[model samples]
Target: MADRVASDHESITTVRATLARRGSTSRPAIELPDEQSSSSPDSASSRRDADAFPAGEVVRLVVDGSERHAKIEEYAGDRSIPGAYDAPSMARDPDSASNRLVEWADDKGLELGQSVLVDVIEEGFKYGVREPGERVFYDATEAPDDSLASIAQQLEDN
Candidate 1:
């Protein structure tokens, strides 16, 4: 078996996720629920939000000053949970598909109603986690606009 490797990249965005306790013991300690006004027909049983968190992609989670790899997944869409869209959950591996946030939260002594910062490392692929606080931004170079301009400059000929 090969050991897991880490990737180098900057976070795209950080989300302040408020924690909520799950009703069932079988479920994770918290449910990072995302409720939308409408349903996404294109979304599948997993990777509900491909633009943000892609399933099977590894993410670096910084919990309690420690870093770990986690996979992003969305299970609500599969179960047909109403108003739930792109609700990402972390897993250690593909087989069990369990939420890693639960264990991390327990280790950090985090409770329900608290907020956690989930940083998007590579758009849909990678991400990171930390304590929620002020918003942080990464240094990035903006790509030049390629679209046509609405107003064209008039050319003068001799």
Candidate 2:
């Protein structure tokens, strides 16, 4: 019984050490710019670019020195319209603050697809000391113009 107990303790210690090492060696998450697209023929470059940006990733936003988190939501339509591409919608965690922000924008006559600036805070940093790690600019408008398909076809022909 004593030997069995000692063995289990040793096993637990080894496992804990291994997990700690793995955690310490882990790399930070890489975020890619929205402007970069990966349609390149080289698989390695494409993979690297694709790994740079995560879909629906959560980011911190600082508005008037107040900190809030938002998610990067892709609209995926005509890129010319503001919100038709990558946009960050204010995240609603425990309340409807995001909805209120949207309403405020609407009330202000900010058209959907118009650009709005959002300050994204850095992870694990004091908000006061760190300037926004990333500035997220998204279109305020939501409607997609169907006319872009004809333009795309024209470009493909050229």
Candidate 3:
């Protein structure tokens, strides 16, 4: 009985240590829209409206040294939800956002790794290389001059 207890204690300690390490290294969760909803007519119409809006911005990121483009409005999560309890809760699953991006890329015949360096190019938002898997939360409050050149410049600096 004592031996079993000791072994269990050791296992618990190892698990705790692993969790702590992951917590420290983990990036913020990326929130992607549900695939099912994205195909609905309502969602499609909304997407068209968003594209027509002047506030729409396009962000470009270098995935494996190649330029990849994604609409800022597509992955920015639902803005309707207020505050911390938003549509894509950052606390849900660390890989959710990254996986979504990877899946999208894969569908386009582009391969992405477990980690990716993202350069966000939305206007009015501070341009920078987002942490791996962080682009899903990318958002902008005001529209700026949308420029693909600026994104390329930021990527060069990184």
Candidate 4:
């Protein structure tokens, strides 16, 4: 445990030093672990186990022939809910705000009385309304300029 803590401390110091030297013309290169290495911090397993959602991140889910979006208040193991969304504005009904998953399903003509396949479009949010499965994709280029993905990218670039 002591060794692990020391390693963590060293990693933090390295990250801080890198950040502090960001603008220097001769800033030292920070070597990243190989992508093929499972032990890499950037490994898929580590990221999934880590906090998937930071503030302002929303999960987009595609279920059946429709999509939905939700804000996951917390992560519960490897579970996730997937769907679609509108940037900035969410299609919400005042009476069903607390049950947006059902609302979205109903609005999209998805029948809750039957089994459905739910695939995650992105990480960090969930609103369970179907059986969770592997990651999926949609044409995000159609997303608005003020989308969560765009905002996250901008934040990272800064």
Candidate 5:
């Protein structure tokens, strides 16, 4: 446990030192763990995990179809996100707001083959990304006749 704590401390210190040393050409290279340590299996795993999400970054989910669109705003805190999406504009239409997603497999007459798209909402209270599968969008109607809803469910599971 102590060894692990020490490694964590060392990593933090190394990062801070590097950031502070940026733009200074006179300082020697700051090396915490050398190439051998960085290339180790554990170090590689740590790198992958570290790249998961950045703190305080925003993530928007846009589910769209013909003549309709739904968007939600959230912050990428630790993992994917830490809390629920706080979209105030689309809060009225619970059906169109949170439940509806793009029609990937079938249009089911709702989209009428117009197609659907989902993307990260770019600006606050504005339209977000429309590319499919970029974010999670699901429709839970218990019994939905719309083929698009079925495809959206599949997208969510995937």
Candidate 6:
């Protein structure tokens, strides 16, 4: 392997020169990344297949410090926690909040297609957090104009 550092390249060049002096006609081929993907350093995964989601469902999108937005399913849609959810007894389970929020949203007419930002700690009161709180997002559909992004933008701009 040839290093790109000037010091290493100098040594490799010297060696190749020495081989050429021996009347060797062979040449080593240098390989580089495909030109199409040179823009991104981590490009391999860019070509990988992703899970296909069902169309026409309203999906809740949560955007935070991270660039990615987590999607949560909306009404008629439900996320189930491992134990029975009572909201009053959640702090024991870190993820119990999701089940409770989905339930609460259901009762509040925020059905399957609604997107929401939920305080994981509060929802997990039955399993509340010991320290700070965690925020999770839920989405359940694919309509852009009616998506969380558009709704949030409309809300924010207004």
Q: What is the lDDT of every predicted structure here? A: 0.40, 0.26, 0.26, 0.31, 0.25, 0.22
Pick by lDDT: 4 or 5, better one: 4
How well is each residue in 1-158 modelled by candidate 6, as lDDT tens digits? 22111211211111000001101422211111122222211111111111121222222222232111222212233222221233222323325244433333334443332222211211111111010122222222233443765666566455
Of 3 and 6, the candidate ranking higher by TM-score: 3
Off by more than 4 A, model 1 = 1-12, 26-49, 78-100, 134-158
- Candidate 4 clashes: the total is 6
Better of 3 and 5 by lDDT: 3
Give the range where candidate 5 is weakest over 10 consecutive residues by summed lDDT.
Answer: 13-22
Every model: Cα RMSD to truth: 16.2, 21.2, 19.6, 18.8, 21.0, 27.1
Candidate 5 residues lying further than 4 Å off, grouped into runs, are 1-98, 102-122, 132-158
TM-score of each: 0.45, 0.29, 0.23, 0.30, 0.20, 0.17
Error of 6 at 144 (Å): 42
The best candidate in terms of lDDT: 1
| Model 1: ten consecutive residues of lowest lDDT | 149-158
* Residue 22 lDDT in candidate 3: 15
| Model 1 C-alpha lDDT per residue in residues 74-127, reported as the tens digit of each score | 565421111111222224323444445666667667776776555544454334
Better of 4 and 5 by TM-score: 4
Top-down TM-score ranking: 1, 4, 2, 3, 5, 6
Model 4 C-alpha lDDT per residue in residues 82-119, reported as the tens digit of each score: 22344313422122234344444565454423333322
Q: Model 6, residue 17: displacement in angstroms?
A: 61
The residue pairs found clashing in candidate 3 are none
Candidates 3 and 6 compared by lDDT, better number: 3
Q: State residue 96's C-alpha deviation in candidate 6, in Å.
A: 16
Model 2, 118-149: lDDT tens per residue? 21122221111111222222212122244773
Which lDDT value does model 2 have at 138? 24
